[model samples]
Target: MGKADPKESYALGTAGRGLDPRAERSRAAALAAASDLLIENGWAGVTHASVAARSGVGRTTLYRHWPEAAMLIQQLLAELFQVEPVERTGELRADLIGELRSFLRVLHNPKSERALRVIIDQAPLDPRYAEVLSACSCKGTDGLREIVDEAKARGGLPKELDTDVAIDHLLGPLVFRRLISGQEFPDQYVPELVDSFLEPLTP
Candidate 1:
């Protein structure tokens, strides 16, 4: 699969670009096909023409929206793993636990796990995919950073605390446990991770 062409830049939207339901469905179908192929056959299996065939969307429409297979894969990931807004419930501890739990839910899902593994394996070979993966990661990282910034602003955390490092500590263990160890990253693990990270920063 080739990288996204330098001449064409695709915006985040459906294939037809207008406010048409049919176009939206086609786009969703195409994305689902790409996601499935990536999960099942790895990055090499996903291509513009293959996705068009699998999705039953016309090649013209697929190419019109995503010319490159990498582009399709990137959009597929964006659709699958949406970066949600942080929920601040006026309680830092509760919010922290809630955020990590949401993360655990996604990481524990088999489909997402498969996609992540494919992305990780493909990153070294495909620079385009690496950029896409980094962008996706930034979405989650930025959301977590917002939570840390908000907590620090409210004096819940130490003023000098590094939000980036703080976020790494908060999410890193879950990633290790889920991806590295292949163990069940249970719900109960969320509280302990959140509390331990907060304890030192809190007081």
Candidate 2:
């Protein structure tokens, strides 16, 4: 067989320019297809070929954009978890509660929970997945850090406590209970966790 033309391959799936309605539609279709595949099959089943087949987009189109399943899944998470930043209400207790509740909501979703478990389980096998998960954690941790900083600024945190460690102390129990024990995390537990951390912070 003769050599294939690289330019022809590239042009076959190229999205049109700005204000091009067809290009916009194609982009939306690709994203939606990828997201549905993730929700349905979790991380392991979301290959670029599968996504392209599901989306009706050529493999070249999918490769030209995402190049990998992890990248596509990460993009999906970023879009789905685009929560509004926690507003500083000047009340440390309220702020902490609000932030934690928001995080819980994200984790409690069955789809999200399954996706997270898959990613965590697969990370050991795939370095790229591990990197994707780490990046996602950093993004999430930044939000938690803001809440902790706000609490400190408002005098709700212990003077000598380390913020990172304090965050673990505050939130770690809930994660452990849910992820390890496979128990439901009730809203009532929020106040208890907050109180446990707050008592030490208060003089």
TM-score of each: 0.80, 0.76
Candidate 2: deviation at residue 92, Å? 1.1
What are the per-residue Cα lDDT tens digits for candidate 2 across 78-116? Answer: 444433466667677787777777667657775556556
Candidate that scores best on lDDT? 1
> Could you give me the TM-score of model 2 versus the true structure?
0.76
Flag regions of model 1 displaced more than 4 Å. Answer: 1-9, 12-16, 19-25, 124-127
The list of candidate 2 runs beyond 4 A from truth reads 1-21, 124-127
With candidate 1 superimposed using the best TM-score fit, by how many Å does residue 95's alpha carbon deviate from the native? 0.8
C-alpha lDDT of all candidate models, in order: 0.74, 0.66
Q: What does the lDDT come to for candidate 2?
A: 0.66
lDDT of 1 by residue, 94-121 (tens): 8888787777777866566666776677
Query: Model 1 misses residue 98 by how many Å?
Result: 0.6
Candidate 1 lDDT at 192 equals 85
Best by TM-score: 1
